[model samples]
Target: MSQEPGWLRPHGEPWKRVSERLVYDNPWITVTEHQAVAPTGKSAIYGVVSFKNLAMAVLPLFDDGSTVLVGQHRFAHRDYSWEIPEGGGPRDVDPLESAKRELREEAGLEAAQWLPVMKVQLSNAITDEIAIGYIATGLSPVPTDPDETEELALVRVPFREALEAALAGQLPDVMTVAMLLRAYHMARERALPDALSRAMLG
Candidate 1:
């Protein structure tokens, strides 16, 4: 790696964890309270929300610049959100498998090709949750088997429309916004298959 003039550097001492105790535990998440020292040497009380599974998402793309989106009422935000297929998989499981399952269950679609698009730390300040996203092509319809907890609404729309919605903040989920922007970048840079890129750009 070259040390370019415009590059940034990281130089900092790590935070010191003095003590931690579990305050709440659930199958999906655990909350732990910690007595910690910040990197600046300040004492602080921190509560961390840890996830038990890896987050996964997929953008199911068709050859003609069309995509499948799923809508559901989010409990945390208490609002309806339109997003790509997303779910959680066991940390030990492959993320691609989870992406495929989410596409099937949320959008009733399956893909013959899958490419990793992005990896994100959802909230660096609060949670230890990471999300992985993928772009899936060569799509086919299937029966949806959504999780019992989900009451999903499905829609198919042009890729450009979805991206525009994300850009306008209509789709505010961090994972969805990242995936859409990444997909746009890939299409412009020809990172995807040629025909797919052309179709997506159109």
Candidate 2:
């Protein structure tokens, strides 16, 4: 292959092989060391992942147009965090399934309808993690089945209020914020044809 002018030539056969190997990796993430040979040959290692899986956050709008939010203790930051119902187990289950499961598990709510609102990529730096957002309308309260390790509370707030809270970091979950933002715009633009989503836009 002809060398690209702006691109760097690998230091040696070892660096070239490593770079190629890093790009075509499998499930697990990998890192490769390389040095630029053009303007400057600064040595660096690039971390790469084999495209992350998708997660889901279900924002259920009640009959009154209020959206459901969940408050749970986030062990990562040792604080109670507020977010939409969201979780992911494995790729075996569809992202929508994860959304519905999380809604029931965390918020004790079930929706009669669900709509795909947004698809957000959590991190593009190295991993390809995507968060699929859903708008669940026609909600009804139900029994929640939280695990022993989970302490979750359900809050139904106005959609605008929820958006404000999410923007203010009161929701604290990065994935939740990204999902909401994307869904909010979709709802606003009338991109979602569902009647329930009109409440989300409203």
Candidate 3:
């Protein structure tokens, strides 16, 4: 490929991998060290964290312009956080199926309609973690089936309130923030159904 004189496109030599070995391993993730060559042709060492499962998030929308959110304590941050229902799906399994289960478990609701909204790369610098988000509608109640270790608190709030909270950093989860933004965009642009968009935009 030829490069233009003014601006550079993403066409360039990429990093070359000489070798890699697993340094840390767990049921959910693996950390590996690699002997690599940079695009500049220099020897370098790189470490990467690989997830065994795909990340899945579900945002349940109610008819009255409200959505359900879940609050829980996060392990890595060692703090309490509010987020949309989310979990990991086995790599070989369908992500939508995983989203359904997560919504039911965390929020005690099942959605009759689901829309794949976003696919995001989480911290691409060191972790190969990809997240898939969905907008779930037509919610109905079910028994909460949270993980035994999780003490989840569910809240039903207006979608506008949730978006404002995320903008204010009250909801800091990347998946939550991204999905809410996407939902707002879809609602404003009328990408979703008329009734759904009206409810969300209200």
Alpha-carbon lDDT, every model: 0.90, 0.72, 0.93
- Clashing residue pairs in all predictions, respectively, total 0, 0, 0
Give TM per candidate: 0.95, 0.70, 0.94
Q: Which stretch of 10 consecutive residues in model 1 shows the poorest summed lDDT?
A: 2-11
Candidate 3 has a TM-score of: 0.94
lDDT of 2 at 83: 88
In the range 2-102, model 2's lDDT, one tens digit per residue, is 86886576554332222434445445344443332322444456554543346778877775557778888888589888888887645677777778888
In terms of lDDT, model 2 sits at 0.72
Better of 1 and 3 by lDDT: 3
Off by over 4 Å in 3: 1-9
The model with the greatest lDDT is 3
Q: Per-residue CA lDDT of candidate 1, range 1-202, in tens? A: 9676754655688888999999999899999999999989999999999999999989888999888888999998889999889999999999888888888888898899999978889897989999999999989989999999999998889899999999899999888888888999999999998998888888
Q: Listing every candidate in turn, what is its Cα RMSD in Å to the true structure after a full C-alpha superposition?
A: 1.7, 7.7, 3.5
Once superposed on the true structure, which residue ranges of model 2 sit more than 4 Å away at CA?
1-43, 47-53, 192-202
Query: Total backbone clashes of model 2?
Result: 0
